[model samples]
Target: MERGIIKIENGEIIIPDTPVWMTVGEMSDLFMVSAYGIRKALRQIFRSGIMDEHDAVRPFPYAEGCYAEAYNMEAVVAVTFRINAAACRRFRELMLRRFMEKSLDFYICIPAADCNHRTGYDAAQVWQERHKLS
Candidate 1:
């Protein structure tokens, strides 16, 4: 969603302790960021050195041991559609391999479901296909 900064109103209801927490489905709809983006951001933060045992710079926090960040529509619209889905597929491994590599101060946070990535895959099938294929 939002790439650089996230602002919250005072007393905002925090669903979870992370930067932003919405259902994986809700995020896919509201911001046009697919579940893959959410999943990627989660994995990215873990790998990006942006997180700690308590909080992550990416904003994802978990009640249990998992965490995921929230993003804004504008921030997620920058990924090249032709590669957003593929980008997710590509970076997923990097996330795991580079887990704790270093925290990224900012990311384009592109949406694979956006126009840029329109050429990459069918929008409706963002959730249908698994991202493991290379």
Candidate 2:
């Protein structure tokens, strides 16, 4: 089996929104490591706050809202950033591959006409102004 993160392009991966949350199995497969190790690394990353916003990684109902687990895209990225040293080239490579696949293609379009304030500007433009994306 392909032990790697199921990217958005794969269509089988769970991505309810733009952040791209992945399950422990997906992360473990992506990193080619045990789920326990991913959890350990996540615990450390959570304390850092650079990735995890809260004390515990937010739980997401992935499997048809029947189950929930610590599923945060930012947390995964943060954990990868910390341990992606020379010793973990494979991890870095996987990250690169995932990113290189045009993950940003999944864009959220909010019609400007629907908003009362903005008439001509698209949601993406407003987002750029607020977050300085451009």
Q: Which candidate is the best by TM-score?
A: 2
TM-score of each: 0.26, 0.46
Off by over 4 Å in 1: 1-20, 53-134
Candidate 1 lDDT tens digits, 1-134? 32332222342311333334344445454334577866565555546554442343345454687765544332232222222454433434343445567766863343555543646665435533554334
For every model in order, what is the number of clashing pairs? 11, 4
Model 2 lDDT per residue over 29-122, tens place? 6656677877777777766665545633446654575754655656666666665544235545666776799657576666655544556556
Query: What lDDT does each candidate get?
Result: 0.43, 0.59
Question: Model 1: which ten-residue window has the lowest total lDDT?
Answer: 74-83
The C-alpha local distance difference test score for the whole of candidate 1 amounts to 0.43
Ten contiguous residues minimizing lDDT sum, candidate 2: 1-10
Off by over 4 Å in 2: 1-5, 8-18, 53-56, 62-65, 84-88, 91-134
